[model samples]
Target: MSSISAHGLGGADDLPISGSLAIVGGTAALAISFVVLLLAWRQPRFGRAGHELAVPPPIARVLDGSWFRAGLRVMGIAFLAFMLWPALLGRNDLANPLLGVTYAWLWVGLVPLSLLFGPALRAMSPVRTLAELLDKGTGRSGGEGVVPYPAALGYWPAAIGLLTFVWLELISPSSTDVGVVRLWFAFYLAAMLLGWAVFGTTWIGRADPFEVYSTLVGRLSLWSRSASGRLVLVSPLRNLSRLRPEPGLVAVVAVLLGSTAYDSWSSSATWIRYVQSNEVDVTRLGTALMVVIILVVGTTFAVASMTTAVDTRRSARKELPRRLAHSLVPIIVGYMIAHYLTFLVEYGQQTLIQMSDPVGSGANLFGTADMEVNYWLSQNPTVLASIKVLAIVVGHVLGVMAAHDRAISLLPRRHHVVGQLALLAAMVGYTFMGLYLLFGS
Candidate 1:
């Protein structure tokens, strides 16, 4: 069987270090906790039940109507169109400008949205929605509830996706790979839909990793103070606003930011050739990167949970373990910053290409033909690529801090919004810069 078929989901051959790190960190924490429990066994304490994790709230009453649902349907069709675009018109005459917009919307745009909204994509998630439709058509409910709410799916799928994402970064990290990547995504979408066909969203939610993280974070956050200043931990940390960041976090974030700085200065031609060559199996590299990312992020979740647990026990007037469990959030956060920063760097160039020659792109049903505004803005002295690096750091801070209970409320809006706007603004600026380089009067 081919590598893709064998792996099913890419990144099956993940590096052992990731798992080792998780196990080692978890085991160490467990051991330390065990020792502490033994030491404090005789202390008189109130019996508090072991806390259960909290999941993201269900989609509250939508202020809008089926419009949101319709949009999801449109996205599904658009994704299908993008997958078939290259086949319809051979690569030579392909309308890149149009394709660029579609790619941007699906990736850059959707990423921040997903991160900020706690699996917001799941609501109108093209993949899930498509899966639901297919399940209905096939007369299969997949065994249970609708769309397996995030709580049901747990965190495995996301861990898989994160791992896959890292693998892609190391391997075919090119805009051209969009066609293949989109196709891969569609396949996963099909699988998810099939999952619904077999089990439904309710079941999937129980399996979603993000939901699991959310549950864990929310429950532990109960020690987190509420907006009213009382010990209400059900919600997020309201005061957890993004700060200037600690030095260690800054260093890690710098590495991530610096990755983009280097990429922006490199020729995309060089990077593309490296990936397509014999040295790298486009599939293998993709898988490896994905696993690497998941490990890093998963480790972060582990550390954060430990931190919350420590804080929670202390708040409850219990003798808590003093060990610094998995104090690796800085490293993990730094890597996440690097992963995302690299994407933005490459996107800067793609946006530029579209802005320089919109009409040379030909006509498309999507109206992405003349989206040169971004490229035009990129040329302005004020709209520096450096700003994008800064945004990465800011976004990381937002993502991490918002995970806390008392701090989450202060932000009000989801942190992902900040990242999304930063990316969009950067794209606009870069596109405009490219336009000037190509056709400045």
Candidate 2:
């Protein structure tokens, strides 16, 4: 129940029950899914159904290993290094610059493409690679047409991670401790590998909790689309119909803010000087507000990106408006730019301020980051942060533009040329602006 102990206490004797339960549940789910899938594969009924499934043409397979695969590997390794060695390896805090960039691009741009083209992350998903390893190592295959349960239980791993993160922040906040976090990540990596044994590659594809929750929303609303088909962004409401900001995300943000608030409130000196130095308390309030804002904005961005990707994938028609056609890539890039801009603007200040005055004014901002942000900031400050932020922006733009181009090409020849040029020009202008703020200032 205690947050600190939730992730197995520093003392080997203190094991977290919640964490153990998650691992157990996840393992059980994978086992069941694997068994069922194996049975189906070996069974005549499943075998018959499997033969009826459509197969992709050879040409469609060639595009599988494009930039997406490379990008995923690069990001995964970068994240691994950053997480495993936050103190000596990565950005200013646990905020790995490369990972940040990837995240920005992925959510903004690649997600849309994945929806339109295919499962974007599958190409180089570390999870998938590990799953393949499991399949090969275990000598298991869908020989009879059984479903892959470990792959089916993909969400559990992420769920465990997310839950563990929130608990650490709110209940027993130890993410600030570098050694502890690394140990936790060790467990996380181990658990993820275990998950692969059940799910296989694209495990999350079969069971994304976000998508599942969205389906519920899709069915309830009068304006909701059938959960069966792809979503269209032509209408904003319809495009976003299934997206709901979950309370859990809010709770995560609340815990972060509340922890900071508790720190300030519990400090005798802080409260004593409250009336005399109102500005100090106000600053703490600002910090608290910032935490909540990050949670809300970050969660929203994540939801939007995932939903967009899913819808794009489901839709058979890839048509788009002349302006919006090539807009997907640029939109994602723009999102990355925006995402990093804020991160740089925030983290840069946090690091610099903390360094100059460790315990004076705003030290806690840098000092108290959970493993994710703290590790990156501590490891690589300016270079990683700047690059990551820039990458996110640039990646989003490229992805959006690429998607739009694909959509535009679907139009008549004359329309494609003119439309591409116009979109490119707009993207250039946006890029220029981003550059100016990033460097010109």
lDDT of each: 0.35, 0.36
How many residue pairs clash (N, CA or C atoms closer than 3 angstroms) in each of the candidate models, in the order given?
Answer: 67, 50
What lDDT tens digits, residue by residue, belong to model 1 across residues 191-267?
55556654576534433323322322222222333334333223222212212122122222222322222222222
State in Å the error of residue 82, model 2: 7.4
Model 2 agreement with the true structure over 1-441: per-residue lDDT tens digits: 011111110111122233233233333443343334333323222111112212243532443345645667677556445434333444433333322222233222343344443334544455545555567677877411134554323234443454454344333334445445546546655665554444444444333322222232222222222333322122221222223333233232223223322322323243446546665554445445445543543343333223223124533222122113222323333333333333443444333333322323323444443222233332343444344334534443443334333433244444433433443443343333333322222
Q: What lDDT score goes with residue 239 in model 2?
A: 29
Kindly give the stretch of ten consecutive residues in candidate 2 with the minimal lDDT sum: 1-10
